[model samples]
Target: MLDEKLLSRALLDDDKENLMKRLLLVCVLGLTPLLISGCQSAYYSAMEKVGVHKRDILVDRVEDTRDAQDEAQEQFVNALEQFRSVVNFDGGDLEAAYNKLQKEYDRSEAAANEVREHIEKVEHVAQALFDEWEDELEQYTSQGLRRESARALADTKSRYKQLRASLTRAESRMQPVLSALLDNTLYLKHNLNARAIGSLKGEFAGIKADIDRLVIDMQRSIKESDQFIKAMQH
Candidate 1:
């Protein structure tokens, strides 16, 4: 009788532990979306605690986006050069040429992704800052001050719209370039022969045109970023 009683108690304790673990897992699953939604607010609150504000964060993210675009521009140029070299292959290891082109494609893709992330960050902070600014405008007791603030907000919004449009145009241009690079990479991977090189040479002109358009758009975006940054600082 005593042995049976002790066994029953141990089994109950084990069951309780398993139940607790299950409950914890359910809680984590339920909280995932809530945590994601609240993350930006939590970040802003924490930054405020350390004397940093949303405007400052916005400026920083814009700078990061600008830098990302610059790096992406260079990566795309390098990838174009690699593609050109492959198309003009003289006499060397086909595998080596393919490997170099693949590396360049990978680098260009990573740079494009970074630029996209930075742009998203900039948009997030800019929206938050504008929301807060609009909310605070209601607290102004003087009509003159309120009107001035409203005008300033409108001006900033106008400039931001231009900047956003430029960034979006540049970002959209990347997909064609990426698609061309990916198509070329896959083609070379399958056909590592002289005929493949000859076929790719025909594609080189189209790829070059796409890259040229992307570079022009990116340059315009970078210029817009500079202007926006200056406006914000002022």
Candidate 2:
């Protein structure tokens, strides 16, 4: 009887193992289409499983982009200050000065890249949500409800367009600043001397101007992001 009980227990454990394997196989098969569709689709599908829809992802991405812009503003300002210090070099280690300026440039470039990536994420999930919203309007049996939803979608799209334009403007402004930083960094890299510092002084004005414009545009974009997030939440 003990042997028979042990045999039963063994069979039960085997059944459980088989069940788990089957469940895992089912899960993989279920996710195959989403994976094949693309990374964005797979990401959205995974989020949906956790009850976070594309709309939520879009809002989160916009917030991230806004924060990135804020950080980028700080980075550019810091880079400008570093450049100022380097150009005002009063007999210090030229190599150290160049290294410091290079580090600043790298930080500014990384911040800009982060902002761009965040914007792309926002756009990706937004397009998915908007497309889904448009398609689902057809499933509504009530004409009044369909019209209302369509109006909402249109209003959301309009607001999104404004936000996108603001972001684009801000993004474009970064290019000039980055170019100026790159030029200064490269110039200093090749000519690490007091005379090189004198030449870079002239470049400070242009970089400062670009950064000022970039900051203004980024602030506007951040404000738009806040408005859009509030609107979406409602």
Best by lDDT: 1
RMSD of each: 13.0, 10.7
- Say what the RMSD of model 1 is: 13.0
Over 153-175, each residue of candidate 1 has an lDDT whose tens digit, in order, gives 99999999999999999999999
Which lDDT values do the candidates have, in the order given?
0.83, 0.82
* Cα-based lDDT at residue 221, candidate 1: 96
Candidate 2 lDDT tens digits, 136-230: 99999999999999999999999999999999999999988999899889999999887888899898888898899999999999999999999
Worst-scoring 10-residue span by lDDT in model 2: 1-10
Off by over 4 Å in 1: 1-37
Q: What is candidate 1's CA lDDT for residue 55? A: 74
Clashing pairs in 1: none
lDDT of 1 at 171: 100
Per-model TM-score versus the true fold: 0.84, 0.84
